[model samples]
Target chain A: MKVVVTGGTGMIGRKLIDSLLAMPELIDRDGNMAEVTAITAFDVVAPNPPLPDDPRLTIVTGEISDAEAVEALIDDDTDTVFHLAAVVSAQAEEDFDLGMRVNLDGTRITLERCRALGHVPRVVYASSVAAFGGNMPDVINDTVTPNPQTTYGVTKVIGEYLIDDYSRKGFIDGRALRLPTIVVRPGRPNKAASTWASSILREPLAGHSAICPVKEESKMWMLSPRRVVESFRHAQVLDAVAWGPHRVVNLPGVTGSVTESLQALSRAGGNSARARVTFEHDPFIQEIVDGWANTFETARGLEMGFKSDTGLDEIVNVFLEDDLPGQHVYYD
Target chain B: MKVVVTGGTGMIGRKLIDSLLAMPELIDRDGNMAEVTAITAFDVVAPNPPLPDDPRLTIVTGEISDAEAVEALIDDDTDTVFHLAAVVSAQAEEDFDLGMRVNLDGTRITLERCRALGHVPRVVYASSVAAFGGNMPDVINDTVTPNPQTTYGVTKVIGEYLIDDYSRKGFIDGRALRLPTIVVRPGRPNKAASTWASSILREPLAGHSAICPVKEESKMWMLSPRRVVESFRHAQVLDAVAWGPHRVVNLPGVTGSVTESLQALSRAGGNSARARVTFEHDPFIQEIVDGWANTFETARGLEMGFKSDTGLDEIVNVFLEDDLPGQHVYYD
Candidate 1:
């Protein structure tokens, strides 16, 4: 089996690649183990820390908006595609044309290329909870309609529709997972409005002070990097019959308020670690966060056997084990 | 105020144009009546009946998919746009690329041109009930997420999202009306899967035999041409504030089974007209009709003051008064 991962230079992409390399064998549709022979990490830039040496892995960098480049990258041999490349929410909102070009047009190009292959490759799209906003119910479910208020959200929702339609037409076997905000990210803060959710937890645990832009009570529906990567793998191997008509699913996650996250921090690294976080309310960030649906009734996702983080502490612990290894923890 | 109506040669468009020319004045944002100086009827072909020759009316025939042509047509002076042009369902399904070009890309071009004007124009989009399908509820409501099963439906749903986003950005004040299947259409049947909904009534009423492709129990949510034309005008002059955050609304309509419709036909033209209809079960048409949601709870549309045909008889009466004037109704 051959696979392609778009946005392969990003943190999640890198982690997912690592997991794939660790277990190069995946279950094929006929219930037989298939060995992944070639894995292409296609992105706009080479991995910063550089990926671990693997004979099967190849890194190819190019513009996602370029149809020819995407078409070339997704050759006829490509059996699966993990499409994660996108402009972050804040960046998309700031530059409308850039967002439309990359987020919308790029996805279309990728889908078109896959369709052209005519082999019915499995496509696992990394959609976001941002697809839910604007006159939302208190707790969103699979039935609730997506009315995204942001350009990024709109593009993501559009991607979900395209994936669904493509799957329906038998062009490609597609699955779009509406991922929650990933918490305890290893890297520095990026342009996403939800960056603060991870920044507050990651920085403080690493013995550095971090700013919490929203209130302590601000809630976020979150998943760990570890679980999301697992989700990508699990979604790819599932029987096409399991997905049926709808190719989109809202992945399950733990809903945590900032205060609850801080408590989790205190449990993991004691009082001193929790004390490293400071509140500085940013209205712009708060307004964007407020529009997001922080709670979801993910019955469909759970029924499909997709898992979420057990607790905020577990998520923070996973970050510590996976990212901040060999660092000494300071006691209160 | 100068207005442009795409697909202007169609039945609804012509009726809307007539209504617009009759009034020639609309309520502006600041609660002032503004005179409509010009009305342009733009379409792929010239109006066959040649649209009542009025001094203020102009006919511009061109391809809707041509971006440059659309940009030229929707100049700065254009105050409102009634976007009704589309490749109907069956044609869209048969020719996917054509559908995408005309329905999706054409709408995008029109919106982009309006945005370039810098003067926010009121855009009334003609969406459809086809936007609802695939695991739908027994009765659809405003909150039901659109899961369009056809290419045309996908494009229309996409158009609604584009309009909502453009309006949210303050580029244009937009309203999308999800219209039901129009009944008693005067023209010959087109490529739409639901064309029989109109043909069953229209052909028989015109002293010609009509074939009912589905079973007697096959139900359709329907609107009259008069009510739909009124809806376009109503949607245009309403204050943007009235639309609020969500710009899409399911237009109100009467739901009737094929038997109910034929019974009304019997009432209007007696047994002879009803006898003119013959049952010929076409599985292809049946499949499409079965997928459609026959009942709706259009509270939003009702609350917003959009009206439906009172009954099937009233709809047939409108057709008689409007299309078949001076024709004798033979009673048994």
Candidate 2:
């Protein structure tokens, strides 16, 4: 079996690669468990900390929107593709053309490449809860129609549609998971509006100060990094019949407020770690966050056996177990 | 003010051009009624029956996906655009690449050109009820999310998202109408599965035999050619505030079964004309039609003062008043 992972240099993508390497098994095109013979990690840049030194692993880098490059990346023998490359929400909003080029055009190029292969390779796409916004119901359900307000969200929703149509046409066996905001992401803050969700937990645990942008009561739809990687694996192995006609699902996630996140932080690293966080309201980020649907009824995803972290503590613990040891700012 | 209409040689586009010349006015970018200065009619082919001899109408033929050609078509002087170009459902399904090229890429090219002009032009796009399919409510309401089941539907839905994002960014003032299947369309039957909706009325009125591919009980969400034209005008003229945040709507249309359609046919052309229709059960067409949501509660569209044909009689009468005189097969 051969696997190709786009955006394999990113946090979730790297972790997913690690998990894939550890397991070395997935349901092949023939609907049977098979040993992973080769894994190609394709991205705009090579992995930084470096991926595991395995004979089967190969790293390749190129622009996702470039047709020739993507064609080269996903060759005839490719059995599965994990498409995670994207311009994040804030960055997409700031540079509309870049967002359209990389996120929207990039996705199409990848899908078109897969279609060209003609073997109906399994494609796992990383969609987001950013799929929901503007005049949303209190709690989003499986039936809620996506009305994404941001460019990134629009692109993600569009990608889901492309996946569905491609799957319907038997060009590709595709599944899109609408992920929630990932809590405890092991990195410095980037362009995402929800970066604070991770920073409040990650920075404090690594003995650094963090700013809380939104209010204590502002809740976010969240999942742990560990659970999300697990979801990608589960999504791949599930049979086509299990997904039915619709190829997209809103993955199960826990709703956590800033206060709740702080409590979890306190549980892990005591009062001092919790005290390292301070509120400095950024109205722009607040408005954007406020627009997102923070609660969900993921009955469809649950029925398919996809899981979320038990609570914020579990989310915090996942970071401690997997990411904390390698933290650059680690202190006693 | 100048206007550009893509697919302007098609049935609806030709009629819209006729209406524009007759009126010679539309709401300008400055939010004031202005004289129709130049109306550029762009399509893949020239009109068959010939458009009006009015100097304001200039017919240009070219591929819609050709970015340079589109750049030449929509100049900086362009004030509004009626983007009706697309590959219909059955045709798109038969040739996926053609559909993606014309329907998807063509729309992007059009929008990008408008954005480069730096002056936000009002854009009215012709989406379809094909935007709604698969597991659906018995009566689709304003809140129903689009889950298009075909390649054409997917492209239209994706176009809607692009329009929304562009509008949000103030790049273009965009409005997308999810039109019902048009009944009593003039000229010959095309590749659309819903062509029978028009053929049952159009062919018989022209003293030509027509085939009803589905059962009498089969219902369709339909609109008259005149009403849809009026709806497009209304959509173009309405202020951005009227649309609020979401720039798309399921246009108000009546649900008419084949029995009701034939009854309207009988009223206009009498029983003999109705007798020109014969049933030839096509399971393929039936399956496609069955997937569509035939009933809609377009409260939002109605509130915005968009109108549907009063009933099937009005639809039949629309054909009689506007198109019957020029019927290619007229023998009555």
Candidate 3:
């Protein structure tokens, strides 16, 4: 089936497109499927991994939040829609009007356009762990209730509902995946507060100095970029029975203190990578980090066949092998 | 302590305000004896229980959604804000525009006004189980990750965040209580779909014929009015620490199938109540009833000091003893 991926220029989106290109066996309810027709990548920024002269691939670059741009992306035969476009939490929380305009209005425009087309695709929406918040315990069971700490979470939680409602009404087949912070990202990190976690570890492994903006005692919930792609794929074929009332699932991740992460870096990178990393606590980041929820009860998702990284070593190996520029940054 | 109650003219609102007036010993919090100044009640449709002669009581007959109306509701001395205003789910889902106008807009207006006031008030927000929905199981947990089945749930979910955000920002001390459907209601029931559960039982017990619009096997979640009032009272006093990350708690209720409810009515009302009860099973009400969710993992709320309720006999007795009009025809 033809698939459309939004925010294709994002760090994780780049890898998602790569994974789509590799044509990995897709596990559906009926079992493994060998074919996918085409993958269309759309982004407000430039296309991530510019595909060229390939008949099965199309890179259409335009502002996803724009009506005309989104209209051009939809086709009667288009069967899959992956919506990953969003302003980061920091931007969204700081600029209220901008957040509403982009996150809220932009989403409405896309949904409305799809409604106008009268063709409902298998929509895979990218929701975030930010959908949850408040004074969280070490491990949070959703049974506790969602008390959002930010505007970003509010929009995402609402977006999940919109997707579910449309799906219930037969307008679309929607699946929302609430993703964790992706570590070991390759490119220049965006302005998100959580970026430091990845930037520090990734940069240090690559023989570059990286500063940790929050305290080492502060914990965060994280997954690899590949893990995020897996979540998107799982969303494509999750069983309806498993989803039940909520189409969104809490995607799994490794939860630990920043100190644990540092220890992992020290073990993997010898002395060099460890030395490149330095702590410089920023109050703003510290506030958010302190408020961040690092735990989740993901039994439903785990039972439904979704997978997660075994630990930080596996995450580190993947980044060192595939993400490092040239230096074989896997530790030594 | 100054307290502002919205939608104070309605059945529960009137009763709650009366209880607040009748009980003075229940007003202190955190070792701080309140400076009992005034009780302000605001409603769009009518004035609340007319406490006009009391120097400490003020009633404002204005739309709570209006910014000026909200401004008038909050003042320097205001200590607690009891937000009980909302359009019923049926009306909201049927009339899309009306729901957005009153439920969503009014909520945002209230939140904004609370924020602008600068002084934090103990804001008690009325939330509903309807906010959590989907293809519900035999019994669903309060934290089954809200996948709202309708527009009304969508609006209420947003309301929780709006109030929660204000609380997070230190602009208000907010608590969103997801109240169960209040049963054995002691007034002329409104147009809510769940009204049948009470109406059929109440009317028949008072020696009047009542229409039953759904099947015997249909299930619903319900609470007695006393329990609902008790939950509201608990909301105003729970220590912030006890609240933890969950600012919202799913109020406890009795879950049962329609056959069980009818059986309970038969046991309590004897032959007279049974004779007056008739089943028609309207398609409209059937759609809502069959879709209703009542089984909730309410252990959290029970631990948080919210009392449990389920006896229909108690509900019927309350209406029979206190609210039956002088003429028996009123029940008919």
Candidate 4:
């Protein structure tokens, strides 16, 4: 089976590709294990640190919103597509047209290209918990309506709708996973408001001090990078019958307050690492975080066998083993 | 204030135009009464009966998806826009590209045109209950996430998102109304699955036979042309602060089963008119109607002073008074 991963240069995309390469075979539409023939990592930019040199792997870089480029990338031979390309929350909010062009128009171009194939390819869309906001229940259930407070969230929700409609039309076999915030990110923080969630954990573990933007009681719903990569594979392999008519699902994740995450960080990197984290409340960031739904009753995601990190410590350990690799933080 | 009404030749659009023209003055952004200077009724086709030759009214015919045409129609002088143009449900389902071009693309073009005005014109968007479908509770509320089952519904929900985002950016003070199924329509049946909701009453009232495709118990959330037109104007005048961050609202409407609507028909057009309505179950129509959310808790719509017809009789009376005028239904 041939596969294409858009946003293939990003953190989760690179990890997902590595995992795919490790697997001996992939599940086909007929529920049979088939040999993976080729995989294309398509993105706007070339992969950093570079992908491994493998005969079956190919890296193509171009514009996601360009129809001809997308069509050339997702040809008839492609059986599965992992669409992860997007502008982060804060950045999208800052540049509305760019967000619409890259996020909304880009997703549509990808879906349209898949439809043109005439073969219903499995499209695994990466949505976000930002899909839920405004007046929400304390604990969001599967049934809560998506009232996105940000441009990125709106575009993500719109993409989910497009995927579902296209799937219903038999143009594509799609599955949209509303991912929780990923914790313990390996690299430096970008434009995402939720970047602070990872920064406090990632920076300290790397022997760097990080600013905690919100209160200790401020909570976040998060999934590990390893689990998310696994989710991409799991979602693809699942039978279309498993998803039924609705192609969207909110992935299950562990919820932790800022104080709880800090305590977990101490267990992994010691009290000195936790001491490296200092509080400096930014009301702008706090308001955006406050609007996010922290507690989710994702029964559908759990029932579908999508796994979540057991706790923050487990997430921290996964990051250390996978990303840091034998590196240790020194205490002053 | 100058206003532009897209889909100006359609049932609700024409009625809305008449209502607007009748008003001596309109409420401006500052809650002050302003003179009714000019009104443009724009559509793909000219009005069937031909709109009244009033000095203030200008009828322009063109494609809604054509950005140039849209821009030409809506200039800086335009203060309010009623975006009602769309591809009906069944037609949209059959022709996916056309639907996307007209419904989705058309809405964006309209919003963009308003944004270009830079004056932050008031935009009243016509969304639908079709925005609500798939797995839903017995009664839907403001909070129910829109999971559109059809292409048309998906586009409408997308339009709502666009309007809300644009409103947030202060490009346009937009208000999206999720209209219920309009009953007792004046024109011939269109491609909408809910056409029977009006046809069962309209055709019979017009002294012609009509087909009831679904069972008598099948319920529909309905509103009158008069009330919906009132809603468009009301949405325009209300302070933007009243809507706050979220600009979408599910308009309040009375719910009635097919039997109840027919009973109301009997009162207006007598048993003879009711007898003209014959049942012929169409599973396709039944399925579509079944998927619709018939009950709603529209607290926001009500609190904002949007109103619904008292009952089905009131709706029938509205049609008789507004559309039929001196013409009476003939009882055999």
Model-by-model DockQ, in order: 0.79, 0.87, 0.37, 0.81
Instruction: Identify the CAPRI category of the predicted complex in candidate 3.
Output: acceptable
Model 4: pairs clashing at backbone N, Cα or C within 3 Å: A145-B145
TM-score of chain A of 4: 0.96
Instruction: Give one digit per residue, the lDDT tens place, for model 4 in B22-75.
Output: 983666544577986899999999998888789999999998999999999999
Q: lDDT tens string, model 3, B14-44?
A: 7777667766333343435455567888888
Residue B42 displacement (Å), model 4: 1.3
Question: Which has the better TM-score: candidate 3, or candidate 4?
Answer: 4
* DockQ score, prediction 3: 0.37
- Candidate 4 chain B lDDT trough over 10 residues, lowest sum: B323-332
For chain B alone, what TM-score does every candidate structure achieve against the true structure?
A: 0.95, 0.97, 0.91, 0.95
DockQ of 4: 0.81
Residue A146 error, candidate 4, Å: 0.9
Top candidate on DockQ is 2
lDDT per residue for candidate 1 within A156-209, as digits (tens), equals 988988898889888989999999988877777777788989888788778888
State which candidate has the highest lDDT.
2
Candidate 4's interface RMSD, please? Answer: 0.9
Alpha-carbon RMSD, each predicted model: 2.8, 1.5, 5.7, 2.3
Could you estimate the TM-score for every candidate?
0.95, 0.97, 0.76, 0.96
Q: Which model, 1 or 3, shows the larger DockQ?
A: 1
Candidate 2 displacement at residue A29 in angstroms: 1.7
